[model samples]
Target: MPNCHCFWSHIWNISGGVGEMGANMNSIIEEERVRGGVFKDINPEDEDQQPTVIESLCMNCYENGSTRLLFTKIPFFKEIIISSFTCPHCNWTNTEIQSAGRIQEQGVLYTLQVKTKEDMNREVVKSDSASTRIPQLDFEIPAFTQKGSLSTIEGLLDRAVAGLEQDQPIRKATDPAVAEKIEEFIERLKKLKKVEEEFTLIIDDPSGNSFIENPSAPQKDTALTVTHYKRTPEHNAVLGIEEEEDDRKPVNDLDTMRNEVLVFNTNCPECNAPANTNMKLVQIPHFKEVIIMATNCDSCRHRTNEVKSGGATEELGTRITLHLTDPSDMSRDLLKSETCSVLIPELEFELGMAALGGKFTTLEGLLKDIKDLIVSKNPFMCGDSSTADRAGKLELFGQKIDKIIAGEMDVHVILDDPAGNSYLQNVYAPDPDPEMKIEKYTRTFEQNEDLGLNDMKTEGYAEK
Candidate 1:
């Protein structure tokens, strides 16, 4: 085991690590970094950031190898275990990451477009619990089918090719016809790696821990789309969320409690203490019913609220464009659904739907939130002097938003929601608002695919 021991000392030993490992620790991050939009616990390295090593059997050769495990907390997120094993006899290696704590509050879906050669190099974090799909190929890798990977988009394709090719010899020996068809499909998969055609890569994670690197951060990238939504019952079941009997489940007595606040016992997200969450179903005058949730934690003095559309996703997408021409427009109440995206062409700004999370707020309040989220809280604009050009651009954008709030700027506020659940107030009441135009358009095939409707069979599924 002398070779095995030396190889591990080159990798697992932080105390007396090789120069290559030390160089990695000192490497500077060159990517354009932005803070505030992302919430991550860096888990800074300290004197005791070391892995526990143990001797284990290698899966490849059944020979003894050293396995190392490190338990790290993402904080407010879950505890995660990073484990790696290396076999000396076969020169084999295995690495995996596992969630050791609670599942996220909502599920996340990421859609990335691979249009160029550089796009294939983008990093991706594919959690074991996440599902991967490519719409063009009609290929799907179901959840838990593969170990969690810390790799680039190219690595994912390479792994897929390897898995398919591994069983080809057996398939050819037993069933040549089936093997021929598979071989053709395998060639198609290989051609995809050439970037000859543009394709979509999707990762759907019920646990909300998977991510595709956003090479352009703080600014929107046209090729990437991320959406977060409340997990469905089936998704919850898969995540082990619905298995436990809990009082936090939605109240079963909705009919009798309609117009009354229904309170549920839950834990505070911030403090992990006992708390009460109140939910009420309210009908908007021109819009559908929406559920409002408010939470209060006496132990930690933390209070928060969020809105959720009470209706199902509509058959078509809704696009509402409101021209701001008067100061009164700022007072209009707006319901921004979790699946809604907001855009202002005048400001050159757009807000995507992911984690858009339901918002019951006034036009003025929403504008202020946009300002605070992008400009006021931006790390580059706050104190980073190196990115003065980037900061100047953000500061100018904030000023224009302020002008719009004051009615000095006339801009078109567009809400494009595929779920068709958002609404903007009409001060004219019974009469049509002259300044607002609403359109309902059919969702495209791609939109339906992104929303998981392509695989859904809602009607006559039992008969099949």
Candidate 2:
């Protein structure tokens, strides 16, 4: 029987019919592992079980609504989208947490992080992860007792004190860490003052705007009283004391100041090639209004706004008065909407006339509004020949308009032509009577004699 069993087992192995047997052995091993609580394989009966998915919540304890949310799944790890989160109530976002990965078949998953929250006088930090938010951690900021003035901490005390006169020195006494030193100095001063009356020189830092009121005065301990003294011309004008003028470094046109140029590129609704659009505005100083301008592509005539935040140092005076001007600055109201209209009533015009249009009001105000619009557009027109021509024509018109405003020339009124003949004609009107032009006379200098020199030798020789 034993020989027969061995023969049957050898036949089964040789025929490759031992699949279930090996699986059964693995199952037994897995069972043993499960009994030891270390098994991770799924049973045949539990094959329908799905991986767990969890949604990450904001770690901020005091507030809700985060732009970041992560969907994590166990079993098979995966990742999804990373997006911005903002609180609906306070519009505050949890910048600490970020979307790390996404779980398969589940929602997006985000990485956990710590966040800061301020309550009354305390700031709290909390660590949180997807599906689990931890308690806020309590911490304290150590108070400093170092003795120094505000300028000292700001690294300007030495330079400021150096500029003060010897008779009047600027002294700064900060916290009580230097209390003993201050007391010793005070005692020495008192003794010296008793020996020499009026010999006590009170030193003050002219450059230092703050003052240390009574270092030993307990009643005014909490009170940080500071006196700001303006730099007087008389004080700075003293002999041998040259007030150092701040050397303002020259600013680069392209690099200086803060100006952001955003080029919005899109195809023209009409022609789908390349289109640049922007709406730029000059933040006029002390003015509540902004100027808007736009430009269009030359190829397709596709119009769009070009915006630029360019900083100009030019001084813009207030629009204090607006009265009647000339007809040079007036223009027809072409605005499609009343909201786009900027014509003010009883304002001056470029033509040295008051704007009394068919319906519009002041043309100067309207011109200003147009200027604002043009600036807002900041349109980067194509460098095509056609665009260049258009830009040239526009520039010519601008020059002519400026001349008209300066009362140097008049804007010739002409019928509109599709060929842009009117712009050219208005831009360049040749003098009809060229022959009637005035000619400037010049002295026919006969070498040095034509200079009209009153030489004594020449006069005597001529008389002789």
Candidate 3:
């Protein structure tokens, strides 16, 4: 392809209201928007006025055809370029969507529960970089395997099923056993389309542009969960990002990163893919400093982050509690150390120390993670090993956790760290938050043993 004008740059400059027109950029763009809406196809009736229709060589028939490019912006999102190629001679056609802006800073994960046929009607903007999966069926649609599409959820399934069935006839003639297994699997997928049972649909997009429509609008959709997190080195590679030597250096100490973040290159344990690890040292109010380490892996779509106390272990353990009296409290930042125990006295629920490893997330996010790990990731959900009674109980537990995350239930969240390394954000820094409490207690000998403090000698052993 020949080099052309930078599409995004042109859009930005035009929107900036520059050039001889001397007209307000917003006014000009708004006029075009109201007239053209989001996108428009080249109308054959306006042959003389069509700007995007250009003669192109068709790959299928090696004949001249036409390609049209449409530039538009999604409401509340970024600018995008849409292209369509048509070959009338061979009846071959293709459409693709690309983001005109730079790659997003974070990747996105969307989980939707397809419980009813109506859920399949949701609009989906799936970029080529997005991966789709159904956890129940253990089926996946790999990223970049197909071109991008602006289609509905049902349409996506149809496309995937069609692709899988395309080569089955040839395989059946060549290998009977493999074909039989695939035929069985395809039948299962067909059953899924009929909504035989509820299944979870996950869209993992490292580019952060893919979207699943929400009919609820401003209201929260209980059936869908969306999470945005830092991207990995592999993701950057996929997006054609250049790497620097400084990204691999571990010389950056706690103090250096406080001023500016330092990213380090690492390998993901899950897929051995190039990943990115980040460390930040944060000072807690009326408390000591702690280090938060995060890692992202694009290959396996795994996100891992941990938090450790920056300061030396204190003589006494620490316990922190916050009363969730309002919905805003769910947005507060929380740090749970490797040795922290979580509890909700009102819900009669408790998570043992280090059960979830270390995490630094919001109250709502942590609760949702707990629910997802227990319910959707449960191995029993995959086969007949699980009884309906057991599944119902787990479902109820997830609902209760969701209610807590939604701030519909008033409760006290407690964090107890035997190492005294955990911290919770204080909205009122100078003053005490009305519904929060902190206390220190001497660690029990058992707790010390569990923390490996029993073999430690804080004082000098050189005399020995």
What is the lDDT, from 0 to 100, of the residue 29 in candidate 1? 17
Q: What is the C-alpha RMSD of each candidate to the true structure, in Å?
A: 22.3, 30.6, 24.9
lDDT of 2 by residue, 161-221 (tens): 2323222322334434455544454454344323332221121333221122222234432
What range of 10 consecutive residues in model 1 has the weakest lDDT sum?
A: 17-26
Q: Over 4 Å off in model 3, which ranges?
A: 1-51, 244-464
Q: Report lDDT (CA) for all predictions.
A: 0.77, 0.29, 0.77
* Candidate with more favorable, higher TM-score: 2 or 3: 3
Error of 1 at 117 (Å): 1.4
Q: Compared with the true structure, what per-residue lDDT tens digits does model 3 show for residues 154-228?
A: 888888889889999999999989999988888888888888889999999998988887767556889989999
Candidate number achieving the greatest TM-score relative to the actual structure: 3
Model 1 agreement with the true structure over 1-464: per-residue lDDT tens digits: 12322322333342211111111211111110131212223333344444655667776677777766555443223455556777778877777766644577888899998999889977676888899999999999999898886567998999898998999999999999999988998898888899989999999999988877666654687899999988887888777776555555454666645757988899999999999999888888978889989999999899888889888889999999999998989999999988888999987778988544788999998899889888877666755553878988888988898999999988999998998999999899879999999999999998888778899988999894
State in Å the error of residue 443, model 1.
Answer: 43
TM-score of 1: 0.46
lDDT for 383 in candidate 3 is 93
- For model 2 the local lDDT of residue 143 reads 13
Per-model TM against the reference:
0.46, 0.20, 0.47
